[model samples]
Target chain A: MTAGVPVEPGTVRIAVDLLGGDGAPAVVVDGALRAFGADPDLHLLLVGPPEAADELLGVVHPADRERISVRPVQRGVAMTDDPRRLSRADTTVRAAVAAVVDRTADAVVSAGATGATVTAAVLGFGRWPDVRRPALIATMPALAGPVVLLDVGGSFEARPGTLARHAVLGAAYATVVHGVAHPRVGLLSVGTEAGKGDRARRAADPVLTLAPLPPGAHYVGLVEGYDITSGDRADVIVTDGFTGNILLKGIEGAYAMAGGPPASGGAPRAAALLGVAGTVVVCHGAARDDDLASGIALAAHLYRRGATAAISGLLADHARDGHLTGPGTAADGPGRTDHGADERTEETP
Target chain B: MTAGVPVEPGTVRIAVDLLGGDGAPAVVVDGALRAFGADPDLHLLLVGPPEAADELLGVVHPADRERISVRPVQRGVAMTDDPRRLSRADTTVRAAVAAVVDRTADAVVSAGATGATVTAAVLGFGRWPDVRRPALIATMPALAGPVVLLDVGGSFEARPGTLARHAVLGAAYATVVHGVAHPRVGLLSVGTEAGKGDRARRAADPVLTLAPLPPGAHYVGLVEGYDITSGDRADVIVTDGFTGNILLKGIEGAYAMAGGPPASGGAPRAAALLGVAGTVVVCHGAARDDDLASGIALAAHLYRRGATAAISGLLADHARDGHLTGPGTAADGPGRTDHGADERTEETP
Candidate 1:
């Protein structure tokens, strides 16, 4: 849209939910200020009550005031609010997504209720052409390199078709976002043996083996939980959100128990929401100031790379020819059939 | 019946699966010898090929050879063998369970496929009257005593009745095995907040809250992944096998990534097979020498305390008073139906 201006190369705009997460505006404000000071070109669209926004505006220097903006929402989707309450427009997360949809910001970030953010994004930016369930992908810094874990807390479907689709999304994301060459993908299971794992994992195994992957990604059969940290067996680990979310949190807890994370970095506190039309990052619900800053930086990084549009374009191109389903499997029901299809996308190039 | 003698008080007999795990026979023999030497009164029933059992026999002194018995099963199950092959009698794990059933061995331990060991125990020792899917329970050594995790890799069904049954088993096991004065049971979810998990979890939560726990156990609603490692929220955390399996392995992987395990201990590699009428323990499929030894020791510990029989009695007494569900409920379809018929017990106390 900016004609090769690279969207927000030097200037990155991140819309943050002021009243999101367990700590809310207090911690959110602290994190926004920290992120603002760390990145000279970083701008924030604080989305919450005016009082909360004023707290951050009062702290930042007048010189950096130009980099800060506010889109004050009257209220936030309370943590205790019913999932149906997400339809309300006055919610902070909904307003934050509006900033992105309106092109007032480059990306959106929140540590609020995952369901609300997902609902808002799906409603605001609209699902990608074929993505039924928008996935929350987290990249953990493993022993070898970055390991891309998808569906951290998005869809919870265990259908073989859903898993196979995630494998494609994961592979493409690794290549486009992480710059990995020929990412080896593995299905998380109890054992490495072919027939191991629950019903869904077993059914998905054969499908993935036969289902051709995007360029620079190959199926490496079954892998175990160790692969998430070791990064020895595969670069991309695909799992349903239920398992991924539990695994992610378990790893975080383990790091806490073991004094601290490894020198190679601990479990990521932030995750990028993939499959949505906009770039969104989500930190833990109990995020600290440092965690929030990391989320901000991740949003900045995703914005700088134009990851949303680029990945969307790649998917679009791939889906235009309907090649996303690979060779000869064209009869597969609606691209997002079996899974929850929250981030439905087309089988395009 | 152990001759009504104390069995030397610490005199424990464990059936070690010599042909189990990735590095079997050699590693199993080495691990058994280490466990034997570590515990002076420990006895072993080494099950596998004659040559594998002979490997251990050649090392120990002739006077102590009586502590070591051999059950020669020539055929060994490969890692890739079909899960149905678990019913085969020639496998070492089956032989180990047979030794326990025949009263030659006190308990069975194997680092073989979980399906194989589970099936062997079910067929040999019979199922607990009230349980359908025998839950695999593992105790993690946490800073705060021990955290008991159930259905780590047993049945993967997510039905509410299964979860409730597993809760009873977990709580009873916590009291009988871990000796916790009063175990606090919890449902594992993404957050401690109510209604925070997938449909299966949400459906199981209320059922667990109202389900009749053992005499000294109480349900503490839901706990997060952090609770699993910190042991701050509950003593016994229960979930479907699929999630529990991944979470357990993920913790193990995280600890490995953190250089080593914490000061207390690491993720448990051995899981005590509960729900079966006899004491059985399953080690990691990729177990090492030390891990295999730990599994053997765990089985011996269970047998020594009469853990299986005691836990079974607890469930049986509770079921007789119109507390537990029927066989149909215990093995009901997915979705965890909270409202179910209170029928007669399938397995008698």
Candidate 2:
């Protein structure tokens, strides 16, 4: 599907990858039950072995059993498995993503390894037209607002073109998913100075300045690593997947070192996969029960908000203008649409 | 100077960059005063304007005035100034570094821009035979113990050869500075799995495995960002300068978000500059007086422990064996000495 099927309000069906996490079946079942009890209108498509499905159905209220349906598949991808394993179609993460592409579920949540889930989502749902490489967005609860960090682990390479494109994706995600109407996006660098970063960041800074962002979003030069938690510098922070993943884990580790996290919350173990055609949330491979539950909740929330569809549509506007750097023949076509005027006509005007 | 002059016990003199931080001279004066008051045997060589030095001496007790001396330098490098400005002998940071190189001081501490300080130290102190690029090592107080993080902002690039050399440096620093025997060194990668990192990491991993470390130090394979705080996986974490700096700042920001750091301390605002011949410590550009004081204290600690000489002494042993990668004439000479086996003859043998 080029675009995700529009999610209906108050009835979000999420495909849960029962065998996705290190504590598979057990922790996944606990997370599913918790999410089911909290969100009355939520439904779950259990994709794993029949025994694992039976384990969850046993504890769930019989009346609520109607909300959950089992899709049995014994084969699942292990954390150490190669990404090519997703082609088998029987892996729990692949099957979970397939449910969304086939319209059997509104979104997918997996506590599996990020690489496996990202590969499955890309293979199953396909990438967005303007997104050559997908991005994973992780939000940290800063004092001012939530800091949206992108490309957490979608890909390792940090080409200048990819960093700029991810900036666009991150800006849209911040506005649509986090409700930041006029999001301030910044390129994550070692220092906030003009020429303060590795070669990729130095090259990406000028490109980000020229790249046309969606309506109500502006690029605010370079930001330091501290901005990720302070939220005083920018709302959306763009970085290479390698640096983003390391930074997230480092922040999480620091929180753990500092007795506990602040009253707001700890570092997020779940991240939303952007640039895919379907809504997907990936939890940490070693996810705890609450982390899985939070991942499920994040998926449901994104589905309910129609975030995937809205973000894709916003990017489509930029894609038509050739503002987003991607691999596509349509980018130079005469049939391309222009809605640049429509963007500024809103609040930003 | 290829080798630093050995420091005398109970008479370690430190050169303080008077015009170093965002709050120059004033905050530096406060820091120098604090450092002077705390250590009875410490001597200070103030390197800045004569006016700034006189202001400091105005407040000091008459009896202790003999311990403080002035090396007048009217010019100071600004954060935005070109790094080449360090070539000007008039700059305070360069003058401070010269003090250590010329045996006027045992160590140097600067709260200036990291790039400028690194440049000054390299120019004044010269580099060790096997170090192509200098390294900034910051030790974090993790739950288990002090976690040694290297290349905080030594350079921007991450070549395989450089990373392997940095592993050796980090391993040696942990052993000598932190008093940790049998230091388990780990390359900071996205995952602990063998093949999970950027191209540089993939290439460097194997080199690290084959790279012979000093006494009681061994490669522990790839480690994640969590290892930087938990200290469970590795005692010495090696990463590229860019990633290391960002991770350090991110952890510091996380601690701020979580209200305060644990009882031990927050992420260090000061770091020791390695690979140079003399002892040097660089504080954050935005460091407070207490942070500068801590930086001074760190410089004092390194001077007292004779860390720079010892680390270089150890690296020289590797240089003699041609185990280190660098462009140096001394590395190819037959006159290179042998002191590595001596390190282990005491206990590891």
Candidate 3:
């Protein structure tokens, strides 16, 4: 690595899973080069087959190549493969997670099968204390600023408790990462009115209002799809993974259909994985080179800012006061333990 | 109302809710006037408080006033009003539905509360035999052509049978209205691969595959949000009401954010309410003058083409045979009534 001037003392290292994504090695190679070229104090741990790493090594200059370390692994989790296969020992994704667990890298970045990355992260980096479901947070560049949308493609959750926890995670992220002052948080639904959605949204509405928010954040009631684009109503928009995932993809598709995104910005293809005890950014499965570079940049930014520790610390403090506590327990929702439809009996009637 | 030509033999009469939407009376009046101006032989039964219709009557030429009839209902259905109130005769929406049932109007158009419109339509026209849940179908301008998405905001149904019935309705509508050579129908889910979604989608997947389709349609397995905008994969995209409604709004919001829609067209705010015996178009609750006008135009087009009757006739023919003998029905599991999640217990595991 080129030892740069002492701007930030510690160099942040990111483990890039080269085998992930539809484009695989070619796009991944191009993205890694771009990310490395942009960040002077950044280092990359290439985790995949040696040949894939060599492909990147062949192109980059010898001076920058020192920053790149290769962790050789062969197998990859396919799009159609079982999500649990990320747990397999020789798989590149699992190896990449192992590198982070072993302190070889400060953060992880992948464009692999989302379920696979999520599983690997959950299994590798221990879940945050009292945080059951680790969420995938995507920040879209809106007219006003970056609008933080969470649970875009993590665990599928519908319980009021999970929603409440995700709201807290989102609020903390907005304040710590985006530096928003008194971030306004909103729950995503069809209509802005309190009772304008289906049964799950109806149950979650009052619960969100009643729950305590992180310092400098307040619940702004329900927000419609427009707020996600305008970023006028709320800084943080929270929803179930199922809805968020589809909404994110829908917006992306819309931008494509419209020829391009607005002059302000467009829907994001990369999302930061929160709730795990590490910094990770997951890119779209069909991401382009730039999207992967964005994912890499996000991972580096999170690592530099110590976002994981700060947000986790915020949650720990919030939990100690028993503020904004969910149903059953703090460790009872999407990330922490396995809960099915039966657990929602209290809110479902 | 500008009657430029003599009324045709099969002139379709549409009841226009003149006091609906945010910019009521003004926008609705303008929309009704525009729709009349556009369609030479169309007839309009204006349903609202007399003041709204009076505003329209003052502007129209004397000879064209005969083409416009007013039903002086005192109250319009407020957006915040309970949907159950739609059954009351005093409401304009209910009276509008009554016009259709009374054979005064061939169809109805409203930019009011979706729940109210659905409730009034179900009460007045009655759902088609065996149709427990009606769907809202919207045609999106896609790259390939029109991509028909259903259950935009009709009823929140997660049942497999409801989805299956929606498939039949969508296939029939695509063939009769859109006139695709061989419509390819897809079930909207998280992934194209089998077993790639939540419980509801998983349950609906096989049921949709096994269920009978209407003429000139083939099941193309699972589709994602992108398919709705791109239309490269399927002509008809199907999903639960909750998901479809949110996706439609999300796309609409994106187009608005991007300044405008693509050259082809933008997301539609107007959707056709299917499963009711009569033809009805529901615009967004926050619809502007142009949106209201577009809804009216869609209604007139549907009425002129006899699309409702043709689709209904196709379904009737299937009913007569006691089974849908369409393209994809004879390939898989047993066909059954009742589309709830309970039906999938036997098929899944």
**Best-fitting candidate, scored by DockQ:** 1
lDDT of each: 0.78, 0.78, 0.77
Task: Give a tens-digit lDDT track for model 1, residues B164-219.
Answer: 89988989888987789799999987777787776667777888888889898999
In model 2, the runs with Cα more than 4 Å from the true position are: A1-9, A328-349, B1-9, B84-86, B325-349
lDDT, candidate 2, A1-349, per-residue tens: 0011123359989999999878998999998887788778889999999999999899988998999999988987775666455456778888898888889999999887777787788889998986777888888878788888987887765655667778889999989987899999999887787767765666678878877899999999999889999999999999877788889999888899888887767778888899899999888877888787788888888888889999999999877876765564232233211111001000000
For candidate 1, report its TM-score: 0.92
Against the native chain B, each candidate's TM-score is: 0.91, 0.89, 0.89
Q: Which stretches of candidate 3 lie over 4 Å from their true place?
A: A1-10, A324-327, A330-349, B1-10, B321-349
lDDT of 3 by residue, B1-349 (tens): 0011123345778898886776787889888887787766778899988888988889998899899999998788776666456557778888898999889988999888788788788888988865767788989888788898987878765666677888888988888877886889999876787876666666678878877677668899988888889999999998877678788888888898898888778888788899988999888877777777678777877787788899999898866766544323332234221122221000000
- Tell me the spans in candidate 1 whose CA falls farther than 4 Å from its real position: A1-9, A325-349, B1-8, B330-349
For model 3, what is the error of residue B212's alpha carbon versus the real structure, in angstroms, after optimal superposition? 1.8
- lDDT of residue B76 for candidate 1: 73
Which of 1 and 3 is the better model by lDDT?
A: 1
In candidate 2 chain B, where is summed lDDT lowest over 10 consecutive residues? Answer: B340-349
Error of 1 at B292 (Å): 1.2
Q: Write the per-residue lDDT of candidate 2 for residues B1-349, one digit (tens) a residue.
A: 0011122347889999999888998999998898788788889999999999999999999999999999999988886776445467778988998888788988999888777787778788888876777788898877677888887887754655566777888888988888899999999888887767665666668878887888789999999988898899999999877888889999889889898886667788888888888898888888778888788888888888878888888888877876765654222233211111001000000
- Please give me the DockQ of candidate 1 compared with the native complex: 0.41
